[model samples]
Target: MNIQNVTVIGAGSMGHQIAMLSALAGFDTNIHDVNEEVLKQARHKLNKIMDKWVGKDKISMEERDRAFEKLYFTTDLEEAARHADLVIEAVIEKLDVKQDVFEKLDKAAPDHAGLATNSSTIVSSLIADVTSRPDKVCNMHFFFPPLVMDCVEVVKGEHTSEETARLAMDVCKRMNRTAVLLQKEISGFIANRILFAIQKEAMALYEDGYADFKDIDKITRKALSHPIGPFELMDLSGIDVGYYVMLQQYAETGDPKDKPSKTLVDKVEAGELGKKTGKGFYDYHSRI
Candidate 1:
């Protein structure tokens, strides 16, 4: 199916960037958030990002203007998604919350519209049963910093149709992302499952007093030839996000090890979320 009218639910970092990508690809994109303040901030952030891209010669002024012309923001979910050909949900990672969104989207969105979740860990199967249109539901997981991250995982849930999967891959191609198709559902999908294994080991090393977090980050980056270390990536992804995903996994599998690390839980409880909150494993308050 040709997805020309795109709607993104949520206006957080991932949501706005995905919406921007849709607009840049010449799709009519609508970004929706429950809070008007968040929508306003997302609009400002998109403009600033476009300006920076233009300044760096990454995109032309005409490209920026054309994207803006096709992009819009709204506080109403139904209003944003009613006519949309695809609704990408980029909200928080809680399963219940995602299910609520899918339920609402299934009711509000056009019948032919495909519903996709940008969740990193949770699978669409957990959310799809809430709606009657399970055949049209799938997971289109985007990595951190969606603008720069070129890989997007198009995951197929139990009821997701081949057409839905193909349409998702097509949408990824339109957004300049390399689509990685997963024929089966897994909790964290491909990239995140591998990254989470690294995270578990890194946390274990820190707890064992093998190395400080900074040293661990430095050594992993230097020795492993990685762009960023596990701790740093965790901080970038939000400690709370990791904590909740871990908890969700633990709940699903009853694995004691899947329970969030004490350090992560403590940091999240203390409200040291990540770059968004100005603090995490590393402090961005001073750096930025």
Candidate 2:
């Protein structure tokens, strides 16, 4: 399917950047959020990011201006989805919230518009049944901070049609990102599943007093050659996000082992959600 217009349902960390990428790809992009303040902030953040990109010579001023011209922010979901040929939902990672959005998107979007979720763990199969066009619902999981990440995971749900998956892959290509197509749906998909295993082990080691979280992170970085330690990565991605993902995983499998760790629970309860909030596994107040 030919996609010209794109809509991103949410104005949070992931949604705003995804909308920017769509606009940069020459698509008429609309970013919608229930909170008008969030829409305003997203617009401001996008401008700052684009300015930085221009300064770094990643994009020319003319190209950035053109992208801004095509990008729009709205508080109305119906208005955002109306002209969209594709809608990527990047809302909070709660199944019920996503299903609610997908149901509404089903009614608001055009008949041919493909609906995708940018969920890292929640599979599209669990969300597709809520929409009338289950075959058009697929997972287009973009990594955190879409601007720097070049890879997208395109997952085909049980009811998702081949055409819908192809459309998502094509859209990713247009946005100058690599797409990895998964023939079958799976919880946590590829990268996250591997990352989760490492995180789980790290958490266990920390919780068991085998080593301090900082030391574990240092070992991983120095010995394993990882770009960052698991704890640092969790902080970068938001501790609350990992907490919710763990909750979702436990809910799905009824396995106690999948439950969120005590450290994660405490961090979330304390409202220290990493770089965005200036605290998580590490303090970011000084840098901020």
Candidate 3:
């Protein structure tokens, strides 16, 4: 399948970068969001990012300009999906919200277009049955800060066709990303499952007063040689994102142990959603 036109639904942290990558790959890319303010913010943030890339000699000025030329921002979902050969949904992690977006995409996107989700934890199988084209639906899970992250998990849903998986992998290659194709559906997939275990242990230690969060982070960075500690990474990725992922896992398994930690719940309730919100596990307000 030749994917010429790409559409990204959502203009938040992950969506905007994914759209930029598609545009950088020479695809006609459209980014859609319900909020015009978010569309404005995405455009501003993307410009800064591309400018940084040019300054670092990662991409030429001409390349940045050409990529922006192919990129578009919109508030209309139908308009965004109408000409798309592939549509990647990067909306909130909630299952009902994703299902609603896929149902709308099924109605608006072309008959041959492939629908993918950039969800971190929610598997596409839970979402595919809502759309008529279950065979074309798969998980194209891109990590946070996609421009910097090189890997994409192209997961095949229970009903997803092999062709759809191949098309997703091809799209990843076009974006200069390494794609890891998973044959079966699994919640949280590979990287996150492993990361969550580390995070869970970190949180448990912190909550039990066995170690301070900062000390725990320091130990991981110094002792374990991790570039960033679990707390720092959570702050970078948004505390609410991990909180929601935990909630989803709890919902699926009815496991009380899977619930979000008190620290996460408290941070989310306080609207400290990480770097985006100026405060999460750490305060970014001082830096700003």
lDDT scores for all predictions? 0.93, 0.96, 0.95
Q: lDDT: which is higher, 1 or 2?
A: 2
lDDT of 1 by residue, 32-115 (tens): 999999999999998999999999999999999999999989988989998999999999889989998899999999999999
In model 2, the runs with Cα more than 4 Å from the true position are none
User: Residues 60-131, candidate 2, lDDT per residue (tens digit)?
Assistant: 999999999999889999999999999999999999999999999999999999999999999998999988
lDDT of 3: 0.95
Summarize candidate 3's per-residue lDDT along 1-288 as a digit string, tens digits: 878999999999999999999999999999999999999999999999999999999999999999999999999999999999999999999888999999999999999999999999999999999888999999999998999999999999779999999999999999999999999989999999999999999999999999999999999999999999999999999888999999999999899989998888998889999888898778898987
lDDT of 2 at 7: 99
Query: Under the 3 Å rule for N, CA and C atoms, how many clashes does model 2 have?
Result: 0
RMSD of 2: 0.7
What is the Å distance of residue 185 in model 2 from its true position?
Answer: 0.7
- Candidate 1 similarity to native, TM-score: 0.98
After superposition, the stretches of candidate 1 with alpha carbons farther than 4 Å from their true spots are none
Candidate 3: worst-modelled 10 consecutive residues by lDDT = 279-288
What TM value does model 2 have?
Answer: 0.99
Of the two candidates 1 and 3, the one with more favorable TM-score, higher being better, is 3
Residue 223, model 1: lDDT of 100
